[model samples]
Target: MTIRSSWSRAELGAFGEQVAVDHLQAAGFQIVCRNWRCRYGELDIVATDPASRTVVFVEVKTRSGDGFGGVAEAVTRDKLRRLRRLASLWLAGQDRGWAGVRIDVIGVRVGNSPAPELTHVVGVG
Candidate 1:
């Protein structure tokens, strides 16, 4: 396995998103979309939790190291606000009824280890 420390910032981010997707799928989430974007911003992943019949909007944050802060700290209040707006835009474009909507954040920490550390925060906003 390739460690996160070897990748560039952009590559680390993309790798983290893929890891997040895999984690969600393993947790029984059906992926609806990936990298959905608009004028507002971008959503990393859109998934449905079959058990609760809810639409989940996911934001992915990745860091090769924690020099600045931990991966979770990267998600600021402004980010959450933007995510909420983006979620509204997504809902507006949807025709089906959703039981509910939620915002989640996946934080990935990449280092010299073979596998990166992943932290999932649910219903963050």
Candidate 2:
């Protein structure tokens, strides 16, 4: 098997998304979409839970550490607004008729120091 080179920021982000997917699944969130994008911005993960019929819009932020800022700190009000817009668009394209909707933020810090830590912040109105 050939191994691809990991040398770009975009590649790193993609890897982070994969890690985020595993983390989300382990937490019982069924994967709906990955890298869902619009002209405004992109959503890292969109999941649906069958038990609660809740649609969750998740923002995955991978950072080295709190050197510059924490992953959650990166989500600004404007960003949330954009994410909401995209989430609305996504829902409009679907007929799931979910019972509830939520906005979540999953921050991942991956490094050699320790195992990846996933912090899921739910209901980010």
Candidate 3:
């Protein structure tokens, strides 16, 4: 049996996240924020869904292989709570609150392909 390494997995995950962001842009999501970090947590991407007129808080997860778990599995209840708190801080800093607020997840699988597979789960929370 071969033992996989953590660093390799992290690198692949990061690459997938980059692809996911590019996919989001191509899909007409205007990126309002990226990698917004606070003492509590970080938001991978914050975008505006034009059709819905909503502020989208995006959580990006990337996976190389599903042996351990899918990318979405990384987002736990505690993680969501932290994300919500960070989102609040972000909105407060911007001094802007629109009619709609949506939580989205962008899951990406990184591989040899030029464009990775992107699955966007909208209003997940």
The C-alpha lDDT values of all candidates are 0.88, 0.79, 0.75
Error of 3 at 32 (Å): 0.9
Per-residue lDDT value at 105 in model 3: 83
Q: For this target, which candidate reaches the highest lDDT against the unseen true structure?
A: 1
The RMSD (Cα, Å) of candidate 2 is: 3.1
TM-score of 3: 0.81
Return the top candidate by TM-score. Answer: 1
The CA-based lDDT of model 2 is what? 0.79
**Candidate that beats the other on lDDT, 1 or 3, i.e. the better one:** 1
| Clash-forming residue pairs, model 3 | none
Residue-wise lDDT of candidate 2 within 1-125, one digit each (tens)? Answer: 11134336676567667777898788787999888888877888999877898999988887655775776687899999988899999989896699999998877766635466667788886
Q: CA shift at 100, candidate 2, in angstroms?
A: 0.6
Residue pairs that clash (backbone atoms under 3 angstroms), model 2: none
Taking the candidates one at a time, how many backbone clashes does each contain?
A: 0, 0, 0
Off by over 4 Å in 1: none
Cα deviation at 108, candidate 1, in Å, is: 0.9
